[model samples]
Target: MISLRNVTLRRGTKVLLDAASVTVNPGEKVGLVGRNGAGKSSLFALLAGNLHEDGGEFLLPPSWRLAQVAQDMPETEDSATDFVIAGDSRLMAAEAEVKAAEAAGDGERMAYAYTALHDAGAHDAQARAQALILGLGFKTTELNHPVNSFSGGWRMRLQLARALMCPSDLLLLDEPTNHLDLDALVWLESWLKRYEGTMIVISHDREFLDAVTNVTLHIDVGRLTRYGGNYSTFEETRAQQLELQQAAYDKQQEKIAHLTSFITRFKAKATKAKQAQSRVKALERMEKLAPVLASAEFTFEFKEPANLPNPMLVLGDVDCGYAPAEDAAAGAMPTVIVRKATHTVSAGQRIGILGANGQGKSTLVKTIARTLAPLSGIVTEGKGLSIGYFAQQELDVLRPQDNPLEHMVRLAKEALPEGESGREQDLRTYLGAFNFSGDMVKQAVGTMSGGEKARLVLAMLVWQRPNLLLLDEPTNHLDLATREALSVALNEFEGTVMLVSHDRALLRAVCDEFWLVSRGSLAPFDGDLDDYQQFLLDEAKRVREAIKESQKEARAAAAPVLAPAARKSSSNLKALQRDLGKLEQQMLELQTQKNAMEARLSTLSDPQEIGELGLKMQTIDESLADIEDRWLAISEEIEALSS
Candidate 1:
């Protein structure tokens, strides 16, 4: 258990928490949420022991193990699996003892060290590390790749995996899903749900919080409030609390008004003078219910486009991906992720882009946004078509050196028509609408926080008054309130929207249909996000099973050398015979199912249906594992008997 008793914390002159107290029970999964810059991270810092409270007392079990994701980007050349395995401090310590015992040539010491190492799971250390890596959305082949080979986003994922690999009683995670794709986010949610340790997570993702958290802790106005349920329940409970507060405030105000009016009118009248004085006394004695001051909400909507272009975009056999490097040798072909993708973006259509990480969801959106050119085929734009594109990386579309006003002025110069008025005051007013008022408009984009930068980008996007909006992970840095607001805005927009996001709530609220990118092709998804989650789980299982099967093949290839060691095990021949017979029957049934599914997969034209059936075949493959292992054992026994 952890407790913060009337704790006060400050950073420089700003007070983050004032007399805030909250108790977190053991094994509780708490979602710490607040608006951007509302001390959620500060509270995390307090819990992590990086900062001390200026006043009051904070307590935690002193012996409890703690783990948190490191913020610094890793620069080491170590293999990814090895790096994650290093996070298991107990295993590392046990291994160190084993080596020290070996160097000292002490048999008793070596025996104790070996026992400790086994207790710490030293044998399956690599398997555990690799499992965490794969669950965080890395390819099986990349498990042993150099850590520094991955990009910054992927490296952050590795850092998260390392943290999760640590054996901890208390875990703290801050914005862990900011870089994850939908598939990876879903995987993480499932993993976290099964975690038995106490977890305090700071995430802007509503669905994730709802799924993983059993408690909610909110920070507002230097106060901490504890709620008994998930994010959705907290929202509902808080709304009702606010309503009751508002009603009390209103009743108090009415009573105060009546008291003041009576005193003013009757104080001069002799007969009512005593009554007025008594009324004044009563007013002074009464307790006041203060008015509810709601937190400032940030919201903005896309301006209606000047013209609606039906069939805003038409792609004919377009291959979406990257082109070869300029310094490449002659005849270098482009890297095409999605082959022959043909689709139309019509007016008022809402389409959600779906895929696993690296499956080209972002590539498809980039091609449509014209940031990346298509490898081949035609992209036709209808007359009066206008596009408002939100790149996944804010810096991709923003000049970090410039401020919000400069960004808007540049957009006015390039996007606004010659005859149209593009006054600075109007731009300032518009920026204010997105909550970038006063000195903030002059603040350099590079110095602003991620959520603030996202707001600035949205402000500029709205100014363009584009009919077609192509948004890529727009909610990655947005808080829950802002995400809901964006959902509403998108719903009200009269133009078309093509969104690529891992925010399930936003997707459910705004998207009308989906397009899935997989295996070098694009197809219309026939089911909902729930089905997509199942597909991702199946995909991950297949990756794990494939790794296992490859290991089995490697072992079989080396079996000849192990023949001598495997002999003389014929004592269990009768038991081995019975096991092999039962395993053979199970294998026969699984093989029949596999053959049927493969045949069905061949005839299926619908992509979603094919994917579902293919996943079934993978399940059959898993069920047949026992038969293979038992058959090998029986063969070894028979050979040993003959020898």
Candidate 2:
């Protein structure tokens, strides 16, 4: 359990929390939420022991192990799998002990080290790390890729994977989904819900908070408030409280005003002087009720498109992928991810791109954005077409050395379409609409936070007055208010929209249709996100089966043939056969249990019930893994005897 009673927390001279109190029991999943500077991360810091309360009681058990994602970007040449495995500090420590024991030739210590290592899950450490890697959307072959080979966003994902790899009593995740795709995000939500430890996560994603957390902790105006339910329930409960508080405050104000008026009218008369004095004393002793003040919200909208083109663009047998390398040897082939894709995007059509990671969703978007030229096909554009593309890595397009003002100036020089303002003051005003004002406009872009940079890009996008908007993962850095604002803007925008986002709320709110990119093809998916999630799970199960089949084949091929006169081993083979059958039956039962739990999970709105289901599913997965291994061992024994 963790408790903060009458706690005062501060950063410099400013108080972030004043006598705040919160209590969390073991195994509770808490969603910590607030505005950008509302002390959510500060609270996380206190939990992580980097900060202490300025006053009052803060209690967390000393024996509880803590795990948190490292904020600093990792720089390492180690393979991704190795990097993730190292996050298991207990395993690392046990391995170190083994190494020292061996070096010193200490038999007793060596025996103890081996026992500790086994207890720390040394045999399955790699498998555990790889499972996390694959769940987070990494391909099997990429497990051996060096950490430094990935981009910054990918590196951050690795960092998240590392944090999840570690076993802990308490886990802290700050914006864990920022770099994740929908598939990865779903996997992570499932993992966190199944986690036996207490978790405190700071995320602006409402759906994520609703899915994983059972408790909501909101910070506002130097106050911390805890709610019993998830974010949605918290919002409902808070709205009712605000209404009640406002009514009470209004009633209190009326009484105070009436008393003051009577005192003013009668204080000079000898008959009423004593009564007025008593009224003044009563007023002085009364506790003033504070009025309900809503938190400040930021919102912006897209300007109406200059012109609406009915058919925004048409792709004819387009090969959406990278072209052949210019410096490659003669007759080199181009790598095509989405082959012979044909589609027509029309005016005011809100299209959502849906696919598992590495399914060429980004490749398709890049082709439309003109970041990558289509290979061997024509992309016919509408006569008055204009596009505002927000790439997954759009920030890379911004010049880090330049300020926001300079970036806008450069954009104006390159693409200041008619009727759009290109004046310096006009650009500054536009930036201000997105919360960049005064010194912020002139400040270096490199020095700003990710959310600020995202806002700057959005401001620039709106400035274009584009009739076609291409947004990929746009809500990654946006807070709830900004995400809602974007959803509203997209809903009202008089333009064609194509979005690829992990944020389910944004997807449901904005997209009227979904296009799926899978297995080197593109097609319309006649289903919602829920159906897609089930599809993903089914697909994953099939993949696992295929892998198991391939491994069985490999083991058979590698096994040494026994003597021709192996009739004596018939009884041994029969025993192995019985064991294999039992293992197979166990696996079938576990898988059945997993499937039923998953079905229940889809329909369950209660976080606690979902969490329970998740835990059951995890146990079933481990049991299946164990059964499969034993099943394979039995099969091998039979094969060796028969071959």
Candidate 3:
């Protein structure tokens, strides 16, 4: 349990919380939300003991083990698996004790250390770490790679995996999904749903919040408010409260205005002098209500293109991938990622690109953006075609040392169409539309936050007046407000859009169709996001099955033929088989119950009831997963005995 009673938290001279109180019960998954700079992260810092409260009581279990992603870049040469395994400090300590005991030849101490290691599950620590890595979209081959070899975003994913691998009673995650793809995000949601610890996650992802959190803690204007249920419920409840508050404010203003008018008119008259004096007292004694102020809304639109082509871009039997580096001594062949991809993207089409990580979603987008030439086949462009591309890596297109004004000026000179002015003043005003104004326009792009850089990219894109937008993971670092603004703008835009993002909310709101870039091909997906989620699950299962089969074959190839006497007794094998069958039956029953609960969830109209059903289903699924693991272990024993 955690409690903050009338807590006042301040950083420098800015007071984030004044007399704010909140109580979080054990085992609750809380979504901490607020506008950027609203102290959500500050609260996390307080909980993590990195910051201290200015006043009042801040209570947290001193003995609680806390887990959080490291914000600093990981700089190490350790293998990824080893790095993740190090997260379990207890297990590492136990293993170290065992080694020390053995070195001292202390029999009793060695036994005690061995017991501790077993209790910490030291033997399975590597397997657990590997599982976390795989769920985060890492291939098996990458497990042995040095941690520092990964790019910054992949390093962040490694940090996330390491935090999740830790044994903690309290988990604090901030923007955990920023670097994750849809597949990894879905996997993470399922994992968090099964976590038994108290979790406080600060995220801008609405769908993720609704899926994993049971409570919402909103920080606003030096106040903290707790709401029951998920993000959607919180939003709905907050909307109602705001509406009532606005009505009350309006009514109170009218009353105050009428009393003021009455006092002004009758103060000089002897007949109404006493009443006027009373009215003035009433006005002085009345408590004023503050008006409900809505958060600022961000809105921007793409300028209409000079010409809208029927087929803005075409990839005809193309092979999209990275070309060999010019400096490569070998001058090797181009590494193809998406092959035989023939597709036509026309104006006014909204397409969401879907794929697992490393499956060429970005490659396809880059090919269309002309960042990479097709390895094979021709890329045909229509007459008067224009493209507005937003790269996932903002630094890829942005000149770090250049200010927003300079970037805009450069874009105007390089990408602006004929008849468009390339003047510095015009570009500066254009940057202001994206919220860069005053001295901010002169600030270096390298010094800006990711969200600001993303906005700058969008502003540059809009400045070009492209009829087609190719955005890859555009919402990665954006806040909820900025993401909403981008979604609304995309929804209202008349130009064609091709977006590759893990943000399902934005995808659902803006995309009318989806294209899958999987297995080295591009094709239209008939169904929507829900269908894609199911597809990812099925694909994961298939991959697991294939790995199992490959392992089985490898074991067969490695094993030497055994004598008949080497086999285990038939009765023992039969007993193990019987246990496996019972476990399988239990899992099947639980799965059926879970599926029924899911079906009911869809039809239930009440939010509370739906949340209850979802939790119930999650419990059943967890139990089924346990049973499935048991079944697998027993079956493996049975197979070993029979062999």
| TM-scores for all predictions | 0.81, 0.81, 0.80
Model 3 poorest 10 in a row by lDDT: 285-294
lDDT of 2 at 40: 88
Whole-model Cα lDDT per candidate? 0.81, 0.81, 0.81
Q: What lDDT tens digits, residue by residue, belong to model 1 across residues 1-643?
A: 9999999999899999999999999999999988888899888888899999999999999988999999999999999999999989888999999789768766555555665776898767998998889888898789999999999999999999999988999999999999899888998999898889999999978889999999999998899999999987887666556646766456546656756886899789875554465456545522221122123366555786888776899999999998999998899988889999998878777899999888999899888888999899999998999889999876555888999999898889887677665799988998888888899889999898887888888887888888999999998878877776676567556678899999998887677789999988999999999998898889888877888778766655544444333333336566546655766787888898888876775576764565456456546655676456556755655555567
- After superposition, the stretches of candidate 3 with alpha carbons farther than 4 Å from their true spots are 244-294, 327-331, 415-425, 561-643
Off by over 4 Å in 2: 241-296, 417-421, 561-643
lDDT, candidate 2, equals 0.81
lDDT of 2 at 65: 94
Per-residue accuracy of model 3 over 1-643 as CA lDDT, tens digit each = 8999999999999999999999999999999988778898899999999999999999999889999999999999999999999988889899899789768766556545655776898758999999999999998889999999999989999999999999999999999999999999999998999999999999989899999999999999999999999987887676557646666456446656756886899789875554465456545422221121234334466675787787887888999998888887695888899999998887767899999888999999999999998899999998888888888875566888989988877667676577675887777787787889899999998889887888888887887888889999998878876776576567546578899999898887777789998998899999999999999989888877887888766544433232121123334766666666677788778878877875775576764565455456546756765665555555555687778
* Pairs that collide, model 1: none
TM-score, cand. 1 vs. native:
0.81
Model 3, position 622: C-alpha lDDT score: 62
Stretches of candidate 1 exceeding 4 Å from the true structure: 104-108, 244-296, 417-421, 564-643
CA lDDT of 361 in candidate 2? Answer: 93
